[model samples]
Target: MKISNAHLRSFRNHNETAFEFGTRVNVLLGENGQGKTNALEALSFLCLTKSFYASADATVMQQHGTFFEIKSVLLSDKGKEFHVRVTYDDEKKTKKFTINGADVEKFSSVIGMFPVVILSPENSSITFGSPADRRKFVDLVISQSSKSYVENAMEYRRIVRQRNMILSEAKGKDCSSEIAPWNEMLITYGSRIIGKRNQFLSEFAPYIAQTYLDIVDERETPKIEYAPSISIKPDSSLEEIAAAMEQKLAKKKNDELRFQTTLVGPHRDEIIFSLNGMSLKHFASQGQHKTFLVALKVAEFFFLKERCNETPIFLLDDVFSELDEYRSRKLLSLAESLGQIFITTTSEKIFGGAEWNNERRKFFIKSGEVAQEPVTA
Candidate 1:
């Protein structure tokens, strides 16, 4: 899929602007703080229904503005067109999503409709970051690719919150009986989440490994392993896993009460990345960390493509400026062969005069206005 046009109103520094986008290799070039990233963030909001940089919608709207609006025309491979619009109201503190001029009650239903993956310089440190960051990374990718995974993850988180609330209330009180129902709900949803995560890792590991080798030029194998809350053999049933959770709850009841939280579940699960039997987070160099992140993102693209038969839109936010010449060339080459890619850059020198193919287009974004232009060497 590709975005044919976008209209922005009171978004960031933009008062009102509209521009068409290329189907492939659309580069947004401008000086720092000139709204290049803002354009990319606007496009991202259409896909995820949330701002990537701002925590709240009010922060994304221009000062003194009451609301922000983004509208896009998307064309699918089957010759169908989808019109997506998102509006943020500061007074109501709410976001509204519409598709084809019809309001969508639940944002979840339209979240992955036009899947997108963003590779920013900030994402380069995901491998060296905390386990929570990696978990979110994995969850975001899986959630976009699989609706079942997203549903299970949402349900698991809801159950966790409810269970923790009950635990907190039962602290120094006699409300322990209420825990059973929430525990059952947690296990029912959490087990599916864990199972899906494991399955994703099983399929994703080899792809990442191969991509890492290609990018890093090393024969040393990198491995990714899923670490769940409970140990269950590969062939074990969900019922068995739920039973194990029950035993864990019984074992940790006193601690859970003391902490007033649910301690064991998919929320606490982690992913282990190792190279030559050493933890990558602690041992890998900065360059190695970047390579791993790129590999992980490439694997995400392929995984979604293979499953859905559609390539996801890629957003590269000033990542090329951080990489050396060789790495940048490799990334540019990889992007050239992939689906529609929207890239942001503060300098045009990074692209090194790569010619635009029939599918490629370039845009210049200044003060939140986008204009189509030829990329200069």
Candidate 2:
């Protein structure tokens, strides 16, 4: 999908800003804290119905501003147009997502509509941070590719929260009677999540491997293994996964009572990334970590492009700052080869000797507003 234009109001440092994007590569160039990243975040909000970095809607709202709104014109691959608008009211604490002037009651329904793949400095956590970070990375990719996975994940989270509440209130007492129904629900939803994760990881392994091969010159084999809380094979069926979850919950019941939480589920699962048989988190250097993370995101772009009906848009937030010159140029070429891409950076030197035409454009951002005269390389 391609974003033709976007208007942001009261979002972060952008009091009121408008964007006329290029059909291919659009660069947001400015020094740090000049609202370069904020513009990219607004694009993410328009596509995903929320901020990629900020957790709370109020956090992204401008200081003392009561509301924030982002509206965009998106074009699908088949020449279809989408008018997407996302608005949040502080007083009412309501967030609304509308497409083509039609209210989207369920925001989750918009997951794969305009597929997006974001790679920012924060994404380094996927390779260097804790397992929860990796799981989040995996979940977002699958959530965008499969709407059913998104629904199952949301329901599973609610189930776990409710189940944990019962366990917490019991205060180490036996609450089996009260938690039994939740257990059934948990197993039901949790198994589907795990099953989907299994299928996704298996299908995604090749994408990552091919991406690594395409991006890197070395003969390194990147592997992504699913470490579920329950014991099950890679090809385990939903019934088999459900059975395993039941067995695990039975064994962890005592521990759950002591900890006052739901112990056995996908929430506790781990996704291990390894390079040539070595764990990425334990052995990879900073450069390797960045490379792996980039590979993962590039792979995600291809995966989503193939899985979703729309071609995914790639968002790179200050990503060039983290890589060497050679890698940066390589990534730039790769990103340009992809569909539509939005890049935020402080330096325009990377675009040196690069052509800027109708398909590629640059915008100078200063304090949340685009400069009247854009500086071209």
Candidate 3:
């Protein structure tokens, strides 16, 4: 899928702006604190229905405006056009999504319609960041690719929340009877999530390892392993898992009351990143970690392509300027081969005129205005 045009009104620094995008590479050049990244974020919000940097819609609205709107025309692989509009209001504290002029009741149905993957400079530190960051990284990518995984993950989180509430209310008594129903729901949804995650990683591991090997030119292999809170027994079906959870609930009744939170489930799952039997987070150099992050993202792009049968859109936020010449070239080369890519940079020098081609387009962002221009080599 590719975005043909994007219109931003009362968004960030932009009062009103509309610009057409190239089907291949489109670069947004500007200085720091300019609206280069904001334009990219606007496009991302249309596809993902959320902001990457801001937690609240108020953060994305113009300084003096109370509302923000983003409109885009997306062309699918089959030449079908999808018009998407997303509006946010602080007073109402709501986000509205419309596709083809019809309000979409469920956001999941709109996802994967115009799928995209983003890599920003912050992603470079993800491997070395907290476990929650890593889990979020994996979950966001996997969730976008599979709606079932998304639904199951959502249901699992809901069950976890409800069970925790019940634990909080059960003062000194055993909540075993009350927790049984939720435990069953958790296992049903949690197992599906775990199973899908495992399947994705099984297919994702080889691609990631190979890409890392190619980038590092090393003989050692990289490995990604799922570290779940509870060991899914070989003979234990979902029914059996639920039963085990129920038994564990009885055993840990007192502890649950003391902690006032649900424990022993997928909520505490993790992903282990290691290379040559050494944990990457602890042992890998800064450069190695960055390369690992890139490989993981590329593997995600390919995985989506293979699964969805459509080349997913790519968004790079000032990442080229953070990399060395060699790594930057490699990333741009890989991106050029993919579908539509929107890259933000503080300087045009990052492109270096080497990646410039007819299919690539360049735009200048100043304050809130976007000026369309072609790269001159």
Candidate 4:
């Protein structure tokens, strides 16, 4: 998919900004804190129905403004166009998303409609951070690709929260009678989530491996292992997963009361990344970490492209700043060959010897505005 154009109003530092994007590579060039990332965030909001980084919609609104709006024209791979608009009213604490003038009541439904893959500096945590970070990364990728996954995840979270509340109120006492219904619900939804995650990890293994081989010349074999909270094999059926969850819940009943939290669910899962059998977190260098993270994202792009109806748009936020010239150019070449991509960088020197045309244009951003004419060279 390609974003043909976008308009931003009262978003971050952008009081009013408009963009006419290219079909291939559109670069946003500017110095730090000049709203380059904000523009890219707007595009993400347009596609995902929420901000990529910000936890609250109000955080992205202008300081003195009570609302924010983003409108865009998106083109699908199958020669279809989508007019998407996202608006927020801080006064009423309401956020609305519309596609082609029709209001989308459920934001989850709009997820894979315009598939997207995002790689930002914050994504470094996927490799170097805690297991929760890794789970978040995988969850987002899976959520976009599968429609039922999001709802299952949402219901699972609700069940966990309710169960935790019951445990907290029990104060280390046995509350089996009160929590019985929630326990069954937890096992039901939790098993579905674990089964889906297991299936996704199994399917995604090959994509990451091939992408790593395609991008890196080294003979490195990357592997992702799904360590669910419950004990089960990857090929375990839903009944087996549910039975395992029930057994674990029984074992952790006293511990859950002591901790006052749901302890036996996918929420405590871990995803380990390894390079040639060595743990990425414990053994990989900084370069290997970056490369592995990039490969995962590229793999996500292709995976979503095949799973979703539309080709996913790629967003690279200030990634080239950390890479060497060779890898930067290599990534640029590879990204351009993919579908439409938007890259944000502090310098235009990365494109020094690269080809540019109407399909690959550069926009200079300064003070939340497109500063000058798009550079096409």
* TM-score winner: 4
Q: How does each model score on lDDT?
A: 0.81, 0.91, 0.80, 0.93
What is the full ranking by lDDT, best candidate first?
4, 2, 1, 3
| TM-score leaderboard ranking | 4, 2, 1, 3
Show model 4 residue runs off by greater than 4 Å: 375-377
Tens digit of lDDT per residue, candidate 4, span 1-377?
88999999999999999998988999999999999999999999988888989999999999989999999999888778889999999999999998999999899999888899999999999999999999888899889998898999999999998999999999999999999999999999999888989999999999999999999997999999999988899899999999999999999988998998899989999999999999999999999999999999999999999999678999999999999999999998899888999999998888887666779878899999999877554
Residue 339 lDDT (model 2): 91
Off by over 4 Å in 2: 375-377
**Candidate 2 residue lDDT tens string, 1-377:** 99999999999999999887888999999988999988888888876778888889999999999999999999999999999999999999999999999999999999889999999998887888888899999999998988898889989999999999999999999998999999999999999999999999999999999999999898889999999999889999999999999999999999999999998999999999999999988998888888889899999999999999779999999998978889899999999898999999999889987677667888889988887654344
Compared to the true structure, candidate 4 yields what TM-score?
0.98
In terms of lDDT, the best-performing candidate is: 4
lDDT string, candidate 1, 1-377, tens digits: 77887899999988887766767788888888888888888999998888766777789898899999999998775758999999988999888899999998977777677878888876755787777778888888787878778778777888998888888888746456888888788888888877777777888887887777767775767888888778876556778878877788788878888889998888988788888888889898877778778888888877776666566888889988778988888898897688888899888786666666446666777776764455434
Per-residue error for 183 in candidate 2, Å, reads: 0.8
The number of clashing residue pairs in each candidate reads: 0, 0, 0, 0
TM-score of each: 0.93, 0.98, 0.91, 0.98
Which lDDT value does model 4 have at 322?
A: 98
> Alpha-carbon error at 169 in model 4, in Å?
0.9
Off by over 4 Å in 3: 233-251, 354-358, 371-377
